[model samples]
Each structure stands twice: as C-alpha cells, then as structure tokens.
Target: MDYQVNYINPEIKLSNYTGKLFKTEAAFTDHLLVWLISGETKIIQADESFVFGPGSTFLIPRNQLATIINIPKDGLPHKAVAMHLSAERLRAFYNQESIKQKNTVSKIFSFHKHPLLESCLASLIPYFEMQENFPENIASLKITEAITILSAIDKDIGSILANFDEPYKIDLISFMEKNFMFNMSLEKFGYLTGRSLTTFKRDFHKAFSITPQRWLTKKRLELAYYQLTEKNKKPVEVYYETGFENLSHFSFAFKKQFGFSPTTLQKIKTNS
Candidate 1:
C-alpha cells in the first residue's frame, strides 16, 4: 500500500493511503475538522467509539485522547482532507464576534452529509495541487467560513471553540484507568490530568503506591493477557491497542511480565 499526505499549508492537508489499515493513538492539541472522501475511519475514545464512512464529516475537540483506525474499503484507499482549527485562530475569530460561551463536555461532533460543511471542505481540494503558491489569507478565510458554519449549526460550539483554558485538575486514577490504552508520554499524561510532572509523580505514588511506569506496564500487560487468553484476540491486534509502541517491544515486555509470550499464551489457550 502507498501512503501520501499533501499539505496546502501547515494547517490543511489531504491524506491518501492504499492497501493496509493504519492505526494510531492521537492526542489532538487543536480542534480537527475531517472530511472523508473515501473508505472508512473508526475513532475510539474513552467512553465511546464512532465510525465514519465515505463522505462523513466530523469535528474532534482538542486535548482529547483517541485511537484512530483508517481502513481501505471496497477497493478504494482511505482518503481524507483534514483542517486544523488552531486555538490561536479561534481566539482571534471569536474576539470580534458576539458569541456567548457555554460549558460543554469534550466529544467528537459528527456532521453527517451537511451540505455547508461539505462545500466548505471540498473547496480546499484544488489547493492541495497549488501547494507552493497557496495563499495564506485564502486558507484563513476558509477556516473562518467553517467556524461560522459550525457556530450557526450548533449553539454550544462557542464554548468548545472559544474556551481555551487548560485542563483543570481531574481525578488521576479515573482518568488513567479510562485512558491507559493510549500510548502517550508521561509529560503529556501529566498535562492532560492537570498536573505538573513532579505533582503527577507525587500524586500517582500516593494513589497507587507504585511508580507510573511500573503501574502502566503492569496494567497494559494484564489487559493484553486477558485479551489474548480470554478474548482470543491476535497478538498483532492487542499490542498497539494496549499502549505499546510496537509488537516486538510488546512481546518482550509481555514475556518478561507474564513469563510467556503473547503468541504462546494464545496457542495454549487455543489447544486447551
């Protein structure tokens, strides 16, 4: 399979991939607007999962953790156009507007076949070819159009887009339990949990009586073991989803922790 990403600028891109499925854990720093042109995408969050087929458009709020899977379906590659709605731009846009902010929870907002959003995103397609000469103001205008459309469609969007506060202190245990499957640095985890690195380590020790790295590895490997032995899932499928970066690393860690390889456990479970 071939993979390509064309950037009209740092904020806008067109992605095309053929053959194999691609998966990754992402922590979005800016709000993302994605318009799928072909194939399928499944976004798995802490509490919910969403699947978007061809022609689906959605917005993912910033400072959120998710596992994204892109699959090539029906002989077509997984192709999509993504626009990043940066915080800097949003703050500037809302400053001159008289929009009221409301408190809202972070979640993926799907705009299914919305004509306005489709038109807005589709207009950017040609700009991918004009990469070198793409006008900055034109991109800004499109983003403004998108923000306007979103505000008009959803009344509560003002809060999500305009409220730029960092994550407040959250329950570390609860947050970690729900989001342990995502592979992120300790620093990122600390920031998202609303604590400094030192505070995070101190709090984590008080809560779990173990180092963060040790706790995370133990939890991930236990989950992987359960998935292999009880769920009968493939090692390939379990590794990345359980927060490990690669299969070899996952296998090594799994063996060291459990005294047997994931594949060995799977075979034993199957034969028994």
Candidate 2:
C-alpha cells in the first residue's frame, strides 16, 4: 500500500482551542497516540474507560475501535496533540523487531506531565495544521522532541530512547543498518550513542518496546531465516554468519517466531 512516512515516528498533529463531546467513533490507519492537555477528556477502548486530565495521554493501536467520551466544551477547553505511527516504521526507525519492543509500545501509550512537552505540543499545533511548506518536515522534528520529552517523563519509556535523542538516534539507526553483520556489543552501542549500558537498556525498551538483546537476536534470526530459505544457504553457514553463538539457540528462536523450525521450512520450500 502507498503510505506516507512522515507520520511514522515522532510525528505530531496538534490543535489548540476546546474540544466538543465526540459524537462519533474515530479509527486510525496506524497507532494513534493522544496527549490531553487542560480540561478533562474520556477515552473508551473496548470495555475500558480512561479518564485523562491535564497531563494524560492515551494510545490506540492500529485498526482498534476507540471513542472520545466526555470531551469538554466549556470555555477554551483543552488543547491536545495526536500522533499516528506505523508499527513497521517504528521498528525500522529503531533498528529493532516489533515483537520484542513491548516497553516501547507501553511508553507510547502511557501518559504523564512535562512542562516542556506541553509547550512543545502547544507550539506544534499551528504547524501541524498548516499542511504546507514542509509541514511534515517541521512536524517530524517537533515530534521527535515530543517523543523524547515523553521518554524523559516516564521511566519505562526512557529505556527505549536512552541511546537516542535528536540527530544522533537517526544517525545511529543508519549505522546499525550498515553494520548489521558485524559483532556489535552493548559497549559499542553505548559508545555510539554516548550512553551507559544501564541507561541504554532503559531507553531502548522505553522507545522501542524491546530490549536490545531481544531485538538483536530477532534480527539475526530473521536474516538467517531469509538466507536459509530464499538464498538457499546451508543451516550451518546461516547460523555462523548470522552471529548466533550456538546453532540450537538459533533454531529454537527461529521456530518460536516463525512457528516452524528452519529445517522444516527449508524442506517445505524445496518440496514445493
């Protein structure tokens, strides 16, 4: 499908002035993140009801049904920022697998308070609605800051972005893509981003929703799977080249994710 990458990561859409009682359900094509500022708003996800006050945020996963309830109409009411992000884009942006990134997902949905965040969200509202003259470009940078501020306010999310901020995160992801075949360590990753191990782990989870180890393992295994099946590489070659220390571990993880062992999948490919 043709898609816009502008809203993929740290993208923001802001609107000032009051909100009215939402009379209809709103659905998104991707993950929806809403930060409520000032007044009170109610969000309903399935049977659950979330009451967001002045510093509360809510997340709605892609294709999920959600409703905005109790939108206040009194006076200027509340100003808010909403973001729509794709799972694939987020995974690619962080250079990690989407499945292992639970902490990152949690942070995206979690809500908290930050004066700087509020101000940033507030400032972006105008730009978000502009829809002209590099609006997406400006909004993309602003959204990156918004995500960082969100990470700072929440410890869980902090784990994901620990190694990333501003220009460095973008650069680091590019570096990883180029060096995925190399022997990368926590120390090297830390040095690349100027973060300590502990800090990196924390932010990694917070931003990406997956531990670095888990992400790396999955990446390696995924590459191995593609090579064994598509490239017709031998299992031993795939295992060693993918950086797995042990063949058994690689097979186990591969089966766990793909629902079948690599040997089984390869045989099926050959038979077909």
Candidate 3:
C-alpha cells in the first residue's frame, strides 16, 4: 500500500489515510481541534500522551512537540477532521472579551463533552467531501464557533484565546528551557524569545557560552539519551519527541553523544 497523508489549506482540513506512525520533529504552530472519524489516533509529547478514537475530540495547544500514530479500524482508511486556529481569526473574537485579566493557560490536550462540536463538524465535513473550495469567511466562522463552545464550558479557555501578548526577552533562559523541544529555526526561537535574530545569537552566547545551533543539538541529544538509557524508550518512539526529524539523524547523534547507537539500549533491555 502506498503511504500518503494530506493537509490541504484554509484552516478546516480533512485527513483520510492509513499509516503506522507519522513523525514531526517540530511543534504545532497553531492550536487545533481534531475529531477522529474512523481510526485510533495516538499523540505523544514529551510531557503527555493521549489516544483518541471515533468521535473523540482532542484539543492540541501550539508549540508542543508531538508524534502522531494513525491506525485504521476494520481495514478502512483513517479519517479525521481538524481545525487549525490561527492567531488572526482568534483575535477577532478575543477583542470582544476583557484581555486585561490574567488566567492560567489551558492544557495542551483536553477531552470534553461538546455536542456543538459534533454538530459543527457534521456540517463542515460535507464541504471537504464535495471537494469544494469554500470561502475563508465560512471556515473562520467555524473556528470562532469552536472557541465559543470552549469558552462557554471553561472561562480559562476564553482567557487563553484572548491573551495574545507578544513574546518578550525578560525570561529568555526559562523560555528556552521550556520550549527547546520545538524543532524551529534559530530565527523563530529568537522571535519567540522576543529578540532579533542577531541579538538572539549574541545573548544566547552570553548566557550559554555556546551558539544556538550547538546548544539545541546538545540539549536534544541529552533528552534522547535520558529517555533511551534511563527510561528504556525506543529511538523511533522518542526521535520526533526529542526534536530530531528522523531516526537516522537520531542514531548518529546518539552514537556521537554517548559513544553508542540508540539501539544499544534496546539490546540491553532485551538481554537483561
């Protein structure tokens, strides 16, 4: 069977396919709501892991490192409807609320009883099935509708959607430590830390005594090492989670870092 995964544009996306595991070394750029239609979808991040099936909805926060596993049920194609939440569309609805109030962030993943979601999806899926290039306004409204349902259920969610404060540099070290798992360009890392590309390089050297590239590589390799040697995880399982895009790169880096290939851990586990 040929392997394929589709992600067409316009925010409202439909994916129907089958695969063992799809790896993404980078983080999610936008917040997303996904409802599995005909398969078991499993997502694992460094901090959390979840599995969802038919009619199950998952809300994934932006900038979280995750690997998705897709398995079809009953020999059918895996199907899902996903809505990507862009900052622009969210800001429109956010402006109506009190943006000054402080609220803790919503979790990266959450499960809820949202009947509205089912109804909206029922209406939205037909557009995808018909291969219609629907207007952006229509899709944008769907995004707002999802958020509205969320805010009705949880006020904190409303606050998160409303709060779009620009990233700043006051807490550079802390921010990097928290977000380094995201496989983004150094420029993006700089931007998220509220610094220009050049300024980020200079400040990064001052704080860490190394270039951003070297630091990120070392940090990611360290994470892989801990998970492999200490937690006994497989290289394929943790490669994407630790910010490596592919297993070959992960294996090479692992051997360079700790003087042994990642598979050594698995071999040790099997023998002992």
Candidate 4:
C-alpha cells in the first residue's frame, strides 16, 4: 500500500517531511513516532538495525541516536510524518500508582500494520492540508488518541514512558553516546546515567581519555559540520539540533575548530 503525502502541514508538535537517500545522525529530544507514507528506511538504533517500508509505523525513544538512511523504492521520494511527545505532555498522562514502572533501557519499537492507527493518521491529513496552524486542541487529542491505541497494543509502552528512573551504571556508555547532543549539565548527565558526579567523572575518564566537556564539544561540532556542508542544513537549524545554547558561542567554537563559521560554510556549500 502506497500512501502519498502530497500535503504537508507542519505545526509546533506535528511534522511532515520528505527524506533524502542519505544517512542522517540525530537524537530525538522527545519520544517520536514515525509513519512512513511511502519508500523505505533503514535505521540503526543503538546496535540494532530495522528496515521499514510503506504502511510501517515505529516509535523512537527520546535521547537515542538514530542513523537513518532513506531507501527510496521505485524512484519515489521517502515521505514520513512524525509526532513528538514532550516530557511535560507525557508526564501529564502518567500515573505511577496505576502504571507500574520498569527498570529497563529505552529502544525503538516496531508495529505491525495497524488499521486503527493508520486510519487515525489518515484522518489528520485534512487538518494540515486544509488549513494552516492546525488546531492545537485537536493536535493534543490526536497525540492522546495515539497513546491510547499504543497502550492497547502494549501496556508497557505507557509505563516505559512514565517511569523516570536513572540509567543503570552498565548502561551509561550507551546512554551518553545517544544523548550527548542534548545540552544537559554534567550532574544531570550523571543522574540520568545512574551515577554520582564523582563516579560519572571516573567512569567517563576511563571510557574516554579526555574530559566529558571536551568530548561533548568535539562530538557536537563534528555532527554540526556534517549537517551544514553535506546535508545543506542552515546554521540555525544545525545549532539547535546539535545542542548549542547560543549561535554566537557555537559560531566562536566552530570558527576556532573548523577555521570558518557555519554561515560561511553553508554559503560555500550552497554556491558549490
């Protein structure tokens, strides 16, 4: 079944985009659900690889690095719609008393072709295609509807989202690799990695010869450079996506390391 997404209406929370046949490295700040309208996607999550085609739907856990390569089928552009669930929004629906928390790591989940979920997504086409700024109230309901349907399929889905347990010590390496894009403090990183500040520093030094701060800067800049020159992404978009707080700071560091600012690099790429 080929679903053609000729219409795209992007709102604050809901996004529709066309994919290119290039591998992209990104981490989701919020839990994300993606529905492929057509074409194929080969995504690497953690150490796992999953392929999806038309009518395929999947959930991507927040703070996980996803390396996605769009595999267009029959010369068709890879189209996808993604819904993001923010921490605040998910917490509003969470109930620790009723939903049992599980101590586990977050990973991607694949879903079979679900008629109800498909229909729900189909019904949203009009809201975006017909008008601009699709009603936030309705958008909120759509997300809620998605959660309900997912809960019916797997009760653990809800629990996995609601529980906020720090990552276990063993899982720290994987968590940091996926989540370094986020502009979180060292203490926060330690907490999420289930380590105290002292322990985190010790473990981090053992894992990488350099300090965490230095490593993070290098990693972010490395990702940003690719996004700008290779992906042709704007400086502002690259900065935000790679976790830089201010453009000035990002630009300063970028110039120092790369010998040119992002804006200059973007222009060079565009002209060439």
Name the top TM-score candidate: 1
Alpha carbon lDDT at 202, candidate 4: 89
- lDDT per residue for candidate 2 within 1-272, as digits (tens), equals 11112222254544444434432243444566677765676654433556777777665654334445435444645556677555544544456423233445422255556576667656654454344454456655665666556655665553443322222333445444444443456765655565677876776677668877877787777788889878998775566556565569778888898899888988998999
The true-versus-predicted C-alpha distance at residue 238 of model 2, in Å, is: 58
Off by over 4 Å in 1: none
Better of 1 and 2 by lDDT: 1
lDDT of 1 at 209: 98
- Across 1-272, the per-residue lDDT of candidate 3 in tens digits comes to 43453443568777777665444443556778787778777776556677787888778766554666677877776787888887887878877777556657546556543687777765776676455557767777777888887777665676566656666676778877866766778887777677999999999899999888889899988888788778877888778777787889989988898788889867876688
- Quantify all predictions' global Cα lDDT against the true fold: 0.90, 0.58, 0.73, 0.73
Candidates ranked by TM-score: 1, 3, 4, 2
**Candidate 1 residue lDDT tens string, 82-188:** 99999999989999977666658878998998999999999999888873778889989999999999988888888899988899899999999999888888898
Task: Pull out the clashing pairs in model 4.
Answer: none
TM-score of decoy 1: 0.94
Worst 10 residues of 1 by lDDT: 97-106
Q: Write the per-residue lDDT of candidate 4 for residues 26-96, one digit (tens) a residue.
A: 55567877788777877755466789989898888875666666656776767666777777767776643
The C-alpha local distance difference test score for the whole of candidate 4 amounts to 0.73
Distance from true position, residue 58, model 3, in Å?
2.8
Decide which is better by lDDT, 3 or 4: 3
| TM-score of each model, paired residue for residue | 0.94, 0.42, 0.83, 0.61
